[model samples]
Target: MAAALSLLLWAGAPAAAQRIVLPTGEYMDTTSLRNPGCGAPFYQYYQVKGKYPVASATLARQAQAFLQQRNGRYTGTGLITFRFGIDCEGKRLPWTKVLQTDAAYRPTHFAPALVEALYAYLQTLTDWRRASGPNREPANYLTLLSFRIQDGKVVAVTP
Candidate 1:
């Protein structure tokens, strides 16, 4: 009876599996992903309290500031999304990809250099917080950030 009860409790425990759902369809060779030294089941930031690179508003501001200096005046009216996993050590997984789309969500391409520059800038960040498992163990977190562009200017960022 005790064993059965234990099993029941275990089954009732919180889920630790990853739950990533992205609208990404196009493939981008933007950043050469490196092997993450950490293992996962990956979880979205929302799955764990306080497990994100920075507050959403602040993240957008920072990205805007960075891109303002590197936009190169290349024009595009579309959205770019970056999707990947971040390890406990704040390292990105070796499968990061970018997807670009027009305002109507149709697949499109932005200036390759501009997209590549943004990808490189993302890699330079080191403040991502790793999500914790239900058992309080380290778990890689899935990250997705979308950038809104207009005539080569980054007008907004969403995470």
Candidate 2:
């Protein structure tokens, strides 16, 4: 009788396993998962709370100010997109990538300057609240920044 009860209890116990749901709607054991060639975790931004280092309105205002200060000018309307990761300390990760630009103006040299200006402005954003995950641990945040410029002036900034 003791042996039978022990066997029953053991069989009824929950398994100590973890499963993660993939983006393709497939469930996979956490242990069976492998990192892709990207050298980064699969869910890099999953646990992040506040994605942007600064508030949207503040970013927009700063972008405008930066453009005005540098006398940045453009001939036609264009868009610039930037991507980067913010670590748990609210500092930008060493990985900054300039995705692409939709420049529709002459003097193509302005594009690179615009990118640099944006980069410089971003470097000033150090007062960020660290992102936390569901487990209450600090997590890295990935974010995209978009800038719209017309006639050499920044008209909008989106986070």
TM-score for each model: 0.70, 0.60
Model 1, 1-159: lDDT tens digits are: 334222211011111211222353544322333344556476786786434556666766777677777636667888888776676666655354578888888888886777766676666666677567788887777777788877776677776
* Model 1: residues with Cα > 4 Å off, grouped in runs: 1-24, 28-37
What is the C-alpha lDDT profile of model 2 across 1-159, one tens digit per residue? Answer: 334222211011112212222232211111222212222321244445555656677777788797679786645457655555555655545334444444653222234566667666766666655666666666656766767776666677775
Model 2, residue 17: displacement in angstroms? 45
Any idea what lDDT model 1 has? 0.62
Q: CA lDDT, every prediction?
A: 0.62, 0.51
Predicted structure 2: lDDT: 0.51
Local error of candidate 1 at 102, Å? Answer: 0.7
The reply for model 2, stretches above 4 Å from the true place, is: 1-47, 103-110
